[model samples]
Target: MKLIIKSLIMILFAAGAYAADEPDMKAGEDIAMKGTPEGATACFACHGTRTEENKTGSFPRMVNQSQYYILQQLKDYSSGARNNAVMGPIAKALTDKEKADVAAYYAKILFPTPKVKKAASAVLKRGEELAVVGDLKIQVQACNNCHGPGGMGMAPAIPAIAGQHANYLEAQLKAWKDGQRKNSADLMGPIAKRLSDKDISALALYFEQVQINAGKAVAK
Candidate 1:
């Protein structure tokens, strides 16, 4: 009898897991179609359904982004760990299931073609050098170790930092360095704590100027 009960429980758990994995594209489409004022933008307007215009230097293409990473980011934004006025309200309004559905929809989409041709400036170049190779005296690890050589980041965990707004990057780093941002991993927390104001600014500027080669890179 105990064995039969255990089997039933296992079956139920499997079913639940299967349900969780199912992608609800229709729901995602509906959300995209119905742009929320509080959310303040339709994802399709920026990301597009299927096109190369989505691949710009200013906007990190959301197409093909990892679902787990997207979900985590949404949660972070909603909770204020990752703060963006534009994204914060939008994230706050989404249910967990909505977040998951949106993430899935974007993750399944193919990457758009990139068109950005400009390179980083001298100051930005300096910032990039610092990010890729930190000063040992400062006890800073190269951002590349986790964010990848080009700032693409690891899937389902770390997020892509490439092409993010310099202001936004600066703010986030400052938050991390201080105790204001609390939702980061233990490793990141310590790293953030160690960063000086100057270090944070340099890293943010560096990532902002970096262009991601979508075909070769994965954003966090």
Candidate 2:
């Protein structure tokens, strides 16, 4: 009889814990739309609404991301684990609750469709050769093995690289190659280590020009 009572109590406690962790989606939207308590700009201003133009690529699209992933990134920015000068200040200013709220809000937004101009014949030919066949002399794997044929990422872990800003992609690839960024997966470390500077530059340029359909579920 005592064991049965204890089991019931434990179950109730677990239920309460789950409820506490679940984000309130509506409240998150409100906070995201209204701005952080310190009067920072609303996220939509940079990410764009359903019809707005997000031309500068100053902000990466945040829509349709996993809430857990978004929360982790915000915390990383806030704690100085991820170091982007512009984002660090903004992230540091947010309260914990506000961080969760904004994460949920962005995760619920629709992902933006990408539009890319066709590459020049020479560039496209080079990119296709490298992405599909790899250069045997360099010992590089075909990019499509991990990044997918269209550059859609494998999901919650790998980010979609298609249509990311060319400059941003180049910078990140350099960081990874030089060991300046250490947060990547074990597989990524070795793969990045094998890439030459020129190879990295070409791959980044190629991916920046690739496009993917928005609103489709990414691999997770």
Candidate 3:
């Protein structure tokens, strides 16, 4: 409540249009925690509250993300470039400034630690192999090739996939393979299509246990 009030106050006192300056982070935080009644939705409802002790969830973690990445995704959703039923409307409703604001807010948050137990040794090994050096037999590239060291993302596009939910990762991989998700890197579709069930589970579970904030390194 207090945070919301402060955000409102900041907006009230602020002067001039936002064509050239940094976004209002306080306002963004409010929107993430409390969506505008008619415009957008609270991000925390699906994206997790970002609390220190919160468990990993099916929704992608948003904190510690690149600001440019978040804004681009929102813009893509709004423009129909990303085809998510739930996010499309919400992104469409948000004003450009709102999108920028919230993106800035989330970007400043700390990346969460691993919540799930580590995968079995065999699963872990295969996952690492696939992530670090992909499978030549399947024509798959390593996960780290684009996601940067530790899956920190390349910024302005791509995203940090380390420590994301296993279910979410697996579902997205399957979605790409099945053509259920059209918003993606062109390279992802063919790669996903070639993945076996073993690859999907191995990659998902492997990355889920990776801690981007805990000294995890992106494979060289």
> Which numbered prediction scores highest in TM-score against the true structure?
3
Stretches of candidate 2 off by over 4 Å are 1-20, 39-41, 129-136, 185-190, 214-220
Q: Write the per-residue lDDT of candidate 3 for residues 102-177, one digit (tens) a residue.
A: 8899888775465587678899889889988988887677888767776666554557888777888898899888
Indicate the TM-score of model 1: 0.66
**Per-candidate TM-score against the hidden true structure:** 0.66, 0.70, 0.83
Given candidate 3, what's the lDDT at residue 146?
68
Considering TM-score, which of the candidate structures 1 and 2 is the better prediction for this target? 2
Model with the higher lDDT, candidate 1 or 2: 1
Task: Please rank every candidate by lDDT, starting with the best.
Answer: 3, 1, 2
The TM-score ranking, best first, is: 3, 2, 1
lDDT of 1 at 109: 69
Compare candidates 2 and 3 on lDDT and give the better one.
Answer: 3
- The better-scoring model by TM-score among 1 and 3 is 3
Q: Which residue ranges in model 3 land beyond 4 Å of their true spot?
A: 1-20, 52-56, 214-220
Clashing pairs in 2: 154-219, 155-219
